[model samples]
Target chain A: MLPMSDLGRALCIITGASRGFGRTIAKEFSRVVRPGSAFVLVARSGGDLRSLQAELTETEAGRAGLQIRCVEADLGLAEGLERVTKAAQEVATDLTEHVLLVNNAGSLGDISRFTKSFTDMTEVNSYLSVNVSSFLCLTAQILQAFPQRPGLRRTVINISSLCAVKPFSSWVLYCSGKAARDMVFRVLAAEEPDLRVLNYAPGPLDTDMQLEARSKSGDVQLRKSFSEMFSQGQLLSCEESCVKLMKLLMEDSFTSGAHVDFYDI
Target chain B: MLPMSDLGRALCIITGASRGFGRTIAKEFSRVVRPGSAFVLVARSGGDLRSLQAELTETEAGRAGLQIRCVEADLGLAEGLERVTKAAQEVATDLTEHVLLVNNAGSLGDISRFTKSFTDMTEVNSYLSVNVSSFLCLTAQILQAFPQRPGLRRTVINISSLCAVKPFSSWVLYCSGKAARDMVFRVLAAEEPDLRVLNYAPGPLDTDMQLEARSKSGDVQLRKSFSEMFSQGQLLSCEESCVKLMKLLMEDSFTSGAHVDFYDI
Candidate 1:
């Protein structure tokens, strides 16, 4: 296999593509990949997706023959997974030498409560259904829909976080979910050595999630820390973090199953 | 504070106590704690729990006034959790200067397929509902049921595995579940300094789980390695592993929320 410099005519499928780091991924990835590469943007907001799609279609790559499909669906349900994978399969064979599945959709869970306060089974299960279960299931479904074949490179990027490796007070659910997803992809990388799996931690970006963290975290000290980060201008923009992620993909030198952080790079 | 030698007049609650590692924990803990310590054994099999309770009444600890309560409950269901926590509260007041909660119930998800083959959302959700979601919810419920007081010392033991830190092929569900549970406890420890949290990895023990792993693991090499461990008499007995866990608690020297393995000690 030759060293690849770009995501060659690929079918790139991204969850949470309507906002935040995922939106940045859609914009950055579109510019670097080949002309025939297709994009499947998935999210819960259909209006946001259509607007993003419209914006992408207006780009130079859009006029140069790039295909973009907006999938409006909630990633927390089975029906949502089916809709996205079906769309991915539809555009999979069109000038596609590479397949990219970005498992980026996730939830903040209920950070308004401490770990000890999270005793409700239904609530906990509901959180895992989206953050943990759906993420793993969607990845597997997309991989099955687009199987390994000659001249095709399959890459999976699990949008991981520092929370996955370190424990944060009052953020137990989020930490647990991220850790589980990262391990799932790690096992996938181990099982399929040919696959490119990278657990990318996109720093503490100035996204809506940061807004939630700074305003409403259950732990006082943690909430203060996040607020201080925002006030001190220490948070990275979505585009800034996405650039580092794209660099990792372009170089393709990262060890499979490894967690790569934007700050680390 | 004095150095503790035993679980002094404590209320000990253990899940999956009908057999295997959980059963060993019940036996070893009953023998070592103070005379007034109460034991609440929880499992799916009411019959097994009754027999174990009857056998316990024959022991010196039982005869010397150690209270024993059997709760027939599945840790996977919400109702099951409610039953166990209620029973725990009942026995909690008597002989309960210290509180010990052992989270020992878990399931080995289907190892008949590789990670890529796990595409069904419902199947994955069911597995997680039992192993990951229920485990965290149960711990949180127990802690909430028995709020920390000045006179009571609280300790939680999460029965983790080597799989929690290391990924194994065809064992994505088990790995992800264990990894998630460990991070949950780690966060709990960070949030509550008064709580004693131990993520104890009881090596590759000789149990029913090993039997299933040796026979059904989808990865041929991993299955053969487990079989080889069994044939060479290298697997630790449940009693042996339980003894190490007891020592960890008695010595009380491990870092809070740290993952300690049988081999490491």
Candidate 2:
């Protein structure tokens, strides 16, 4: 089991760190890791990453000597993946006792249509290129960047969803992407018994994604439910979900590669 | 439930139908369907497709009045998918009472390496293009081509594996692809209640895939197990596994979108 205190000296890399849950995690996770910890924040938006970098540097962990690197690149593209992996490698220092990578980058594909409407090969391929293929390859690249060594604990967190286990109508791309990612990391856990992998499904959070779901989902009933959840204040805040995730991480008792939901913890 | 004796007057399309389990399915299914039934066999190997077409043409169903069209194309490429869907659209005649689409085309991606070794985006994208993306898009296209209508039962059979539910060491691409495809079809079952979707895991079969697994799989234990299965003749022949699948279809008692294994039946 992990020690009774906050995580010490972790080399944390969070994708999609510019906005939403990724940004919230960056701020909240900073408060947990000790001084001398490093963060590699990656996203496509340069301005947002810069602002996040500034906000993180002013925090307690940052003032105590946290090193923050903002990587403005698309996690979906090969070149963008190269930049992030290279940044993480460069930031992996001798003080890095634990490695925690948050694979949070994803897109809710055109939910305005049903499964049968996704006939164009280019459209489908582009979706998988971003969500499935890139996610798998990026995790592989990051793990490669930080090889296993004595006293160096490695943990991979996938910001997964309920869709990973449940099938949602008109959510073919997002659900399949989540499902594939969960299985990919499960394979990672099976192969590397020493590594810790968690597929954390942050509950339906009140975020831009939820708004998109409410407005654009193809199934009218599903769309209305999202709107109702918002109106009823049933949606979780990013911090609310992240707190549960933090508790799970501190407990460190989850079966490696388990699909743990916010409510499950 | 589907009729007990035989499936009559259907437009049957099978991918990867040139050899292995797919070929067995084509031949076995030919025996069960009535006259005026059409068969669309798709494979990258034109010669193999031609030979299978010829073989299928000599069968009793063929002799009676079965129409066979060979699509020499790769399921991985857009052009190949276009060709198959076009051919299926052309073959959906007035006599076509039922449409059965067998999504059997897939590749066992580079299994000689671990998850951490698959860092190249191109390699990963190419693998997904064939296994994951193409499978989803093709299904959507076929469904679009043959819209749901009165008296026209639509059946989609995904040649899934235990890997769909169980992750294997170093079999990242194949396992995840299967998982994603199963979930994709599950969504299809949810969205289209009238459509029949079955994910059939054919156990371990004595086919070219097994040979490849025994020779090329990275994990020593996994490779040895495959070898042991082969040496002990524990692997089911293609015909044997297909017989179980045939039984499942003929009975048609399975819940739509269920992952029914050969042993389960």
Candidate 3:
């Protein structure tokens, strides 16, 4: 089990760290993580990552010698996945006290109403590639790179969604991808008992993803639900969601192979 | 709901129809389907499909004027998907009474022990492409091409597996792909009430897939289970399983969007 003290020295790798929950989670880690710990942030936007790095450096945690490395790469592409894997390996040289891999990146991939036909094959391919394939590749690489040692804690947190278990009208790609993600982690959990794996559904968050869903002109009911959720203040802020997630991550009582929801936490 | 009599003139599209369950299912379909009904057989082995076509042509069903068209295409590739989609469209032009799409093609991928790392990205991609993406693409195309008409039945039969709901150690790709396939049909069912979608799980059939699983050197427990099942005559033959499936397909009582198992029937 990973104790709060061990988190300071842990090698944490987070994908989609440029913004949204990824960014919030990264920031949360910075606040709690020890100075010896290194953060490897992966995202497509290099500029945003750089800005984040600069921002973190100016913060109290950065002043205390918190290490941060940014890898500008899209998880949707093979080259991007390769880059993330390479960066993680390079960053985790001898500092493998506890390794935490956060698979937070996802793609909705041309959301359309269920009444309409699906998008082109390329768009569908991108959805699976980015959400499912990339997660598998990265998780596989991490598992291979970090063998379970006696005292070393390894935790894989897959940022899944309620859509994974529940079907939504215009969210087929997201739903299926997240479901696949959950199963992947479940399989890994069963195979590697000593390793900690969590499929965490963050629930409705005030993220760009929600904004994108609101922007869609498809399905009136779906749109109305999103709008209603937002207006009712039901969507949790990224910080709020991250706080609960971080709390759960730190707790040894949280069982591995569990599909944990934000509400449950 | 389609009566057994309507099966004769329905346009049937079967993927991976060259051999194994696909081939047997195609043959089973020939026996039941009426005269003037067209069969689009999709597989990588053109030679095998041609032989099946010739063999079927000699049968009473073929002599009765049941049309058979062999589309020798791999569902793992885009071109193959296009070819299959095009064939389905062409065949369904005049015969729009009923259209049946059987997504039977699947790949177990490069199977290995749970302890070992996964196969390369290429092999993994093939599994998702063939098992999930192609299924989605073809279903989408068929749904778009053949709109539901009053008194006409449009049925999509995804030959899923128990592995879809149950996770297997070495069968990660197959399990996840099948799960995704099931969810795809579920979403479709909810959206298109006029269309019938059946995620049929044919339990442990005596097909080449079983032979392949039995041939694996990894995971002693998995191997033992397969060997025991085979030796004990626990695995259903392709013919037996197909019969049950055919009955379910023809039955109006069979609920759409249900994850049906052979035993359940």
After best superposition, candidate 1 residue A91: deviation in angstroms?
1.3
Put down candidate 1 lDDT per residue, B1-265, tens digits, no spaces: 4556887888999999998888889988988898778999999999988888988889999999889999998777899998988898888774478899999988889997999888888888888888888888888888999888888889999999999999999999999999999999999999888989999999999988899999999999999999999999999999889888988888888888999999988
Query: What's the lDDT for all of these models?
Result: 0.90, 0.90, 0.81
Q: Which tens-of-lDDT digit does each residue in B99-210 have in candidate 2?
A: 9999998889999999999888888888888998889889998998989888788899999999999999999999999999999999989999999899999999999999
For every model shown, what is its TM-score relative to the native structure?
Answer: 0.98, 0.98, 0.94
Task: Point to the candidate with the largest DockQ.
Answer: 1
Residues B158-250, candidate 3: write the lDDT tens digits.
999987787777777877888888887877777777888899998899988898888882656788899999999999999999988988877
lDDT of 3 by residue, A134-221 (tens): 8888888878878887667888999998877776776777777887878777777777888888989998899898988877836678
lDDT of 2 by residue, A106-205 (tens): 9999999999988877887888888878888888888888888988889999999999999999999999888999999899899988899999999999
Runs of candidate 3 exceeding 4 Å displacement: A1-8, A93-95, A113-116, B1-8, B93-95, B113-116
Q: What is the clash tally of candidate 2?
A: 0
Candidate 3: C-alpha RMSD after superposition: 2.2
lDDT of 1 by residue, A146-220 (tens): 887888889999999999999999999999999999899889999999899999999999999999998989999
CA lDDT, candidate 3, residue B203 = 86
True contacts kept of 2: 0.81
Two-way DockQ contest, 1 vs 3, winner: 1
DockQ of each: 0.90, 0.85, 0.49
**Chain B vs. true chain B: TM-score for each candidate?**
0.97, 0.98, 0.94
Docking class of 1: high
